[model samples]
Structures are given as structure tokens and as C-alpha cells.
Target: MSFQGYLKTIKEKTGKGPEDFQALATEKGFVRDGQLQVKATEVTNWLKADFELGHGHAMAIYALLKGLKDQHSQ
Candidate 1:
């Protein structure tokens, strides 16, 4: 699936958008001042445990957190 597709599906499943995830990450200290403070594995692990997201979906969120992918991308 495309990046946007993945994000849309995630939102449909979790009722959360990238901004919401970012806020959650911030609360968890995974992100600080718009920068990711943890490794991708740590972020993915948290997503998996809390969100029940699959590996790929978790990675998509990780990409967003790390600035590797943009939430507004086409």
C-alpha cells in the first residue's frame, strides 16, 4: 500500500492521525521537540504493544516520527 493508504488505514483502525501519534510519542518520550529520541525498534515495539499494529504499519509510523516520510505526502 501507499504511504497515505497506510496512514489512512491506521487512522481507520486506531482513530488517530499522524498528529495524534506524534502527541502520543511525545508523551512516551519517544519524540522530543519534533525529533525522535528513540531507535526505530523501540518505536515499533511500542506501537505494536500499544496499538496492535503490524510490523509494516508500525514502521510507517516510525518513518513519520523519524522524518523519513511525511504525513501529507501524496
Candidate 2:
């Protein structure tokens, strides 16, 4: 799916748009400092349990997070 499609799916699951959830993440420092290191398996499980996101969708979220993190690094 395209990036927009991934974002839409994330909205449905997270009940918030990218900016909204991202603001929360930023407050938590997930996108601060430099590197973005997270437990992929843990995120996968959380998405599955909390949002009912399938593997592909969950992976998309992971990609989006990584992308956003990268944007802050530069």
C-alpha cells in the first residue's frame, strides 16, 4: 500500500491522525536525540492486540515511525 494508505490504516487503528499521535510520541522523546531504536517484535504484538493491525499494516506503522524519526535527525 502507498504511504497515504498506510497512514489511513493507522488512523483507523490508533483513532488519531499522524500529527496527533506523533505529538504524543514527541512528548515521550521517541523521536528526540538521535537514533530511533525500538523493539520491533514488541510493537508488532502491541499493534496486534491493541489495534487489530495485521502484520503488513503493523510493518507499515513501523516504517512510518522510522521515517519520521529520520526526518528529525537531519
Candidate 3:
């Protein structure tokens, strides 16, 4: 699936968008000052455990957190 497709699916499933995830990540200390402070593995692990997301799907969010918005823009 395309990046936007993944994002759409994630939002559909979680009822949360990038901003919401960003806020949650900040609350969890995975991000600081809009930058990711944790490793990709850590982010993916959290997504897996809490959101039941697969690796690829989790990586999409990770990419967004890491400021790769160009690809996410669709």
C-alpha cells in the first residue's frame, strides 16, 4: 500500500491522525520538541504492543515522527 493508504488505514483503525500520534508520543517520551528521541525499534515495539500494528505499518508512523512528511503527504 501507499504511504497515504497506510496512514488512512491507521487512522481508520485507531481514530487517531499524525497530530494525535505525535501528542501521544510526546506524552510517552518517545519524542521531544517534535523530534523523535527513541530508536525506530522502540517506536515500532510500542506500536506493536499498544496498537497491534505490524512492522511496516508501525514504520510508517515512525517515518512521520522522524519528519519524513514529504512521503506521507500523498
Candidate 4:
């Protein structure tokens, strides 16, 4: 799937957009001051365990959190 497609599916499954996940990531200390503070694995693990997201969807959120991707981008 495309990057945006992953984001759309993630939002559909979790009822959360990138911003919401950013907030959650901040709360988890995976993000700090709008920057990612941990490794991708840690962030992905949290996403997978908590949201039941598969690796690809979790990585999509990770990209958003890490400022590697944006919600509207393809």
C-alpha cells in the first residue's frame, strides 16, 4: 500500500489520526519536543502491542512521529 493508504487504514482501525498518535507517542516518551527520542523498534513495538497494528501500519505512525512522513503526503 501507499504511505497515505497505510495512514488511512490505521486511522480507520484505531480511530486516530497522525496527530493523535503523536500525542500518544509524546505521552510514552517516544517523542519529545516534536522529535523522536527512541529507536523505531521501540515505537513500533508500542504501536503493535497497544493498537494491535501490523508492522507496516505501525511504521506509518512511526514515520509520522519521527517527522519522516506526513498525513497528507503520498
Give all candidates' CA lDDT scores: 0.94, 0.61, 0.89, 0.89
Error of 1 at 15 (Å): 0.4
Clashing pairs in 1: none
TM-score (C-alpha, index-matched) for candidate 2: 0.60
Q: For model 2, name the residue pairs that clash.
A: none
**Which residue pairs come into collision in candidate 3?**
none
**Regions of candidate 1 where Cα sits further than 4 Å from its true position:** none
Model 4, 1-74: lDDT tens per residue? 99989988998999999889989988988788888999999988998999999998988888888788788888
Between candidates 3 and 4, which one is better according to TM-score? 4
Each prediction's TM-score versus the true structure: 0.95, 0.60, 0.92, 0.95
Task: Give the C-alpha lDDT of model 2.
Answer: 0.61
Deviation in Å, model 1, residue 33 alpha carbon: 1.7
How far off is residue 15 in model 4, in Å? Answer: 0.6
Question: How do the residues 5-74 of candidate 1 rate in per-residue lDDT, one tens digit apiece?
Answer: 9999999999999999999999999898889999999999998999899999999999999999999876
Task: Give the residue spans of candidate 3 off by over 4 A.
Answer: 70-72
Better of 2 and 3 by lDDT: 3
Report the C-alpha lDDT of model 2 over 15-64, residue by residue, as the tens digit: 87656644554565555553335656755675687678888876665655
1 or 2, greater by TM-score = 1
